[model samples]
Target: MKSITRYLVINISIWALLAALSAGVILTSLFRTSAEDAFDGQLDMVLKMLVGELATQLFSSEELSRPGSLGQPRFELPLSGWYWTVSRSNKDELVFASLSLGGENLTVESQSEKQYTGGIGRYLMGKGPDGKRIRILEREISFGPDQSYYFRVTGNAAELDEQIRSFENRAWLLMVLFGVVLLTASLLLVRTALRPLTKLQRRVRDVAIGKSEAIVGSYPVEVDGLVEEANILISSNKETLERARTQLGNLAHALKTPLSVITNEVRSSDLQNADMLVQQVDVMRDQIQLYLDRARFAARHNTIGTVTKADPVLKKLTGVMSKIHPEKMVDYECSADSDICFRGEEQDLEEMIGNLVDNACKWASSRVVVSLTEGLEEAAVKRPQKKNANVRKWLSIIVEDDGPGISEGKIDEALKRGKRLDESKPGSGLGLSIVTEIANLYQGTFSLERASLGGLRAELVLPAIKEE
Candidate 1:
């Protein structure tokens, strides 16, 4: 998937998870509240039943002075899980109290109607009993006129806590399952939505690998734009390839026609002048063919992956010059902060630098200095015109000669194809032209100016190639 669409899927999935978790927590809390209220209601009914039975038994009893009667539970059936204590007061004093003992005794401060029924509410608290923490549910119970008789009921809160804990655990488990289901559903949705894009990708790959000429399927509107762009690029590249091929074919055909004419003319000439004339014609043919070959080399593929390293070029050139002209001195200097490179064909880079260095060697009296720096100057040369900030990361090579330089106004024409300043100089003018084209393809710059050493200085500024 494209970056934006992938992010959208991930973001939606995350929000869905958070929402699911929030809902799970709220629902779990609500379930626990409902369960607690139902359990509390049951507990209140049990307490009310016990209070009613105890009031009836106490009013009919003839053993009111006995402590055993006070300790006896009135209703045994409803008090299955309940604990209780009863106390009697005479003249605002505890005249009688129950013998049931456990954690703490509930104290009654006053006689009021509020103490008779649901006087005090239950709350959670922990009490230390026998060096152990005991969670208890406590409430005060009052009976009879003047509310002098009081009862306190306490129950273990462990069962209620367990119920809440179990509910929370189950809720979390369900939430996790829901989240997984939601994530799986989201991924399926993303996949189904991107199926058309995947088909487009496969078609484009087929075209790239030369398995097909173009995209081969109907696509969605969202994907139509990308398909159209791909088709345009492929068409443009094919046109360029065809044009280059045609130009080469025409150049060959033109040269062959001239060769055929020369052969015919040689056969018609007298034997005396035939050999010299044929030799001259052969030389012309060779020169024409050489220029054509250079032209083909100059028509480089713009997307060719080539990286030019200055140090390697300098090393190769210096090594060659040291072997060929051992008696002559050559010095290589570089002021570049780092290695300067360019994204162009390696053969083209070799030819460009080789031509400049070879020309420098011919003109240098004793020393030929090659310097590499990285920076931009104002655009002067028209062939490889500089444009874009990306070109500023350029490799500028300055080849200086100590010997006499080119005459004024000749440097401009030297770069033009087949324009040689000196006929006596044993070289084709195709070198600079090839270099200019290579630089132009990468949007680099080239210039020929007078060196401070009173000799010709050739400057080649090419865009830097970033190392992977």
Candidate 2:
């Protein structure tokens, strides 16, 4: 399943990035517009001052010289890019100019021209004294009819362009910083908001692994209903299983009482084939016991939080088997990475392992070895999840004895429910079969193979529970 926290964070970051870029673009554009306006306003003011001073020179056609009270000292410097000139608009006659022009003329290009009527001048982009890109503002007025003059002022625009570029660089840097802070804050807020869900998930895992019986915590209002429903479901399932077990036990007892009476009556009688009747009664009893055990194991197979440590169980079983076969001397060995556990009912585990160990003891010459499989660190174990019932982990328990091993062809015959390969052994020939059945019920596997110790190897795999 996809994580909600991851989804929310990715979406928030994308939108924040887009907003930062958009804000940066808009901020720099407004700054550039204001810069252009200030530059143009200064040029317009200087043009007006020159036109007022040169009005007297227009009356008499004296060769033009620098006008007075221009106030800007840059006009005195050669090629300073601050200059004023007066010329005839209809003819190429230079009437007057500032010393800043250095005896060079300024010409405005007609293509990049704009006019502001009602006493405002015309503006254009053109070349100045040294071929530098410049902004020219010119005003034309007629002293008499047919005698008109143009007042021109030119300034280099490199400072204005540089100022705009510097502002854009600074603006983008600040926006990047702002975007980082926004994403970091959003991440922190998302993690904080989802902390309750994380706790709830851990609590639920604890229940599945038998660490807890019920979900308990002070949860948010959004999750209170879920917690209540989960607890109720767990309690109700336990109650239902308990009632079913009680009913099955009662039924078993009720039927067994009549069977016992019939068996005793037939054995006391002296009729023909009385022994055969008793033998049939014994078979019926065995069948009843087998099915009853199967029913009990099936009921507990899917129950939640039923974990059993294998070490204690193995210890107890090995000691009991030793006493059961005093001459065989059975021993238990645990080769797991740590204290591993079986993820099933304790009784089921006992039944499976007990049957294998007992069978080993019965067939061994003088020694029997029961071992828990090694390399448990590589094989993970977990509870059966609700959404995926087939997904499970396994741990192996093995029992081998140094006795006469069966050939590969007869191995299948030996696992049949009532097929005993050796009649001398005092058993019903159901131990191996019963172990196989129990392993199947727990969604596990059982196999018999040639033992390394020159005996039969009975390998039983069962669902396991281990910490991460």
What is the number of backbone collisions in each predicted candidate, taken in the order shown? Answer: 0, 0
Off by over 4 Å in 2: 55-65, 68-86, 90-98, 105-132, 135-144, 147-154, 266-291, 330-338, 373-394, 404-416
TM-score per candidate, chains pooled: 0.48, 0.81
lDDT of 2 at 165: 95
Candidate 2 lowest-lDDT run of ten: 378-387
Residues forming the 10-long window of minimal summed lDDT in candidate 1: 107-116
Compute the lDDT of residue 37 as modeled in candidate 1.
Answer: 69
Measured over all alpha carbons after superposition, the RMSD of each candidate to the real structure, in angstroms, is: 11.3, 4.3
Query: What value does the lDDT take at residue 139 in candidate 2?
Result: 78
After superposing candidate 1 on the true structure, give the runs of residues whose Cα lies further than 4 Å from its correct spot: 1-6, 58-82, 88-144, 188-192, 228-425, 439-468
Using TM-score as the measure, the top candidate is: 2
